[model samples]
Target: MLPISKPDLDAETVYTTCTATARPKSVRPQLQQLTVDLNDAVARYDTAAAGEGLHTLGDLQHQPDGKPDKQPGIKKPKPKAGGLNTHLEAAYTNRLVPEKSPGHGFYEQLMAKAPDGRCPLCSQGVADTLDHQLPKVVYPLLAVAPVNLVPACRDCNFHKGDQAPAAAADQTLHPYYDHNVHDYTWLVARIIEPPKPSITFHVEPPPDMPPTLAARVRLHFTTLKIARLYNPQAGPAVRTLSLNLRRWKLPSSQVPQHLLELAEDAAVENPNCWQAALYTALASNAWYTQGGYEKPWR
Candidate 1:
């Protein structure tokens, strides 16, 4: 996923928008405390270097799974039964819908700022949900924190329900916090030969890469189902797309160590060639897709 900038919104606006439901008196104090904590976190984040600290205010703890942990403590405090606002309920529900129809302005705004008009998670044409980088269930106080919101597709939203981030050395690339992601190229896609009616794909991590980058690549592959066409295998459409035969067919030894650099230059010299090269690489056999090819001798 491309890195994103933090949205320009205030705490009061978010609280009013997200907390329209009535809750118990105990909930009020908890909510207020959360609000204050989030505000302070944001203020600190504004002045820090990129990736200096966890950008969101969610508490970090170990979860059952080996992923980065979050724990949403306490349930909603009981509110007066009749005190909930019907209008607010409607508004909130409308915002939560997964489709990219004419209803939700919040989802639209988030999608407009996302990279390539695609949700990073599902590769869906439109991103209609604002996902929390750190799940709201874990950090209820930061539930409405703008810095935590990310544009996501419905499948991803459902699959990632309240789960923690993958536990690697570096955090998952927060679209807002991590800016240099484009600079790193760790995973490559490739096709598998002897394809049957259905397409098959595979993702491979570059050799000797950092644990965090490898984890991110694996997470993306799983989350998107990049190889799902080979069902019971894993991954989704992009994986199959990688298997298309019209792509690259070269030897690894011939490929240069600085291929990405050359590719960047080619992009500047001839954008079409750059696109072709990338597409070719993606469409090659699973081995080539993951490991890449050596340059050809003319």
Candidate 2:
């Protein structure tokens, strides 16, 4: 998880946008009747989200043992035919946030905060869309709250879709509030060889960090399948390093030193980034830096 600065936009502005052009007939009567003031509704929604952040989204049905059952963490024993979720999905996501609509500009405005336009979740992919910290289906009032929206890459967003935290322990890092990724040495990788060359990633938090935070790191990686997603990409990155060695006419004997320098440069940019973690771990491994490393293909 990468720490991202929250967007400067406000909930009132976004909520107003959603409510402004919504046709009376198009919006559900329940929302119009109950939510007399959009501003108060947004405030209440933000308060609820702050409370929800204290707990992890409950286990999906099969995960009664306190573990999550699948990617994106939807509630177990999924919702039946009809209710508020169904109504909200239709009114909020389908109608209000549609392309070229009045509410769409707010969405675009929030997504523009992503640094380098890269998803802060993985820091490797494009920040193409936004993830609601408190899902829209579960909390319709926050459907367009700027603070609830998090810019993310397609894969990270898909894997984390609509999942709510059941307890504080299960809550994955919120890009805005969770600053561990910015200052901690959490993600680490190792080079794999023998049959082939590959890399594997894992969470290894320092001992001083609280146990709860370390657990969240594990849960985040598990929920997002970060190891599965990141390892394949690391191959190309490692091969590029090998290519650089050959291009510069540097011997394999100097690979360790070169990789250490590369990792240092990356660490200076963002210390906990997956790329930085990869280089740091590679430089520490004798096998990887001393000629076991090889490019699999062109």
Candidate 3:
């Protein structure tokens, strides 16, 4: 996954700034009181997070399904500030996700820092929502913590859910901290011979990476259905390229040049992008470049 820079803004700052906005006369004072309590709750989390990190609040004891149980004595600050939890929960779960609100909403600021607004997890979709690095229910205070919030497409966020890895190998790459994963040649595709040629995708971790990290890469791909999702896209893509070669009546030697262009174009967006890997795989294989692509279309 391509890493994104953590926003300089944190949850507390966002809460204060958001509530300080112009409000209707009816609910203005009430909303201001709730913001105070919400800020206090965030301050408590900040103190607790001083040394252990934000994820420190989520229980390390994971269920068999890989979701960690919420820690005990999980404090939900129930101050007399009437709408505190209401707004706090709403902000964490829903209010912060939409980009329509303009300049300073959490989602907008986060998206501003994204890599061309592409989902880092898939690199194919828009990073439309904020994904909590740790489940918000478990670490409610870190719900808005800058480093803990990631901009992601709905698909990647949904697939990840509240699950934490049961082991190091099960850990999905955290785009912010795991930037190196994108540098490697991980995603790859190959033509599968059959009634018609089609491509299938999978992780092909390089040999030098540690076994654990490699397993993590494979696990990330498997859990996210990277291969399952990417394979379908590859088929139509290969077909299009195959047809183009025929339509243009390109010379055999020039096929590599065209495929290389395809690969390079994809690489410009992400060196390890699926299309780059897919095109590179096709171009590298002698059978495909030598006209294996034309069989299915013609």
Candidate 4:
């Protein structure tokens, strides 16, 4: 995934202040009461996992005894029909999808100045979904923390559900936090024809890189299931995003002229090394042959 800069948080602060001011003193206690109830509910749902292993609110709700009950988790709060309460509803709705929600137009305006008018993860052609770096489920206080919020494709979001605390030596690369991960490139692609219509890609480590980096790469690949595209649920997206597509298309006839030019140029500059390393690498894939151009080579 491409890296993303953190979004501006000024708007969130403004919203919070406005929300507090708009609430009448008479209703403040009621709001606090509701907040307390919500926190209690959250605590109950959260406590079920204390040494109990794999317990979920759903499991509690659907126990074999067939008695549905309210677990400790907080119930959704009811907003008052009008006035200040409606403003509170608007505040939350604004935060739901900061980019598109009109109530949070300030956030959208700030995001518009981002490099691609989208979150890095979203712009990377992955599913667009808001992700909380520190899971909101566990760290309720960070639920609206601007720095903690990130744009993520649906796949990444689903995979990361509720799991925070990055693994030791994880190379999965946080789009916002990790800055030194761009050196390695793990491209995956499959050939469709010729000597062997098979996938061929390389996981290249930077020259003299440390073992931790290699470990991180391995962890990322396995966690993300980057290489196991054959799995029924794992095919399309990751493969498309990670692999160089041109190499999978095949024969010179299918290759683009620009790519052929690039191959020739690289070969000319570093003939032996380019042919053996670069050309051989591209020649091994069908998609690479099909494109014959490399925007990333530079």
Tens digits of lDDT, candidate 3, 72-131: 557544323333333434445544554443224666677766688877776666888777
lDDT of 2 at 143: 64
How do the predictions measure up, each by TM-score?
0.57, 0.77, 0.72, 0.48
Those runs of model 4 whose alpha carbons end farther than 4 Å from true positions after fitting are 11-103, 109-119, 122-127, 188-207, 210-280, 283-298
- The ten-residue window of minimal lDDT in model 1 covers 61-70
Cα-based lDDT for every prediction: 0.47, 0.65, 0.63, 0.42
Instruction: For residue 265, give model 1's deviation from the true position in Å.
Output: 11
Worst 10 residues of 4 by lDDT: 61-70
Error of 4 at 135 (Å): 1.4
Error of 2 at 88 (Å): 5.1
TM-score of 2: 0.77
Model 1, 223-287: lDDT tens digits are 65644523333233334433432255444443333344445564453332223244444344444
Task: Give the candidate number with the greatest TM-score.
Answer: 2
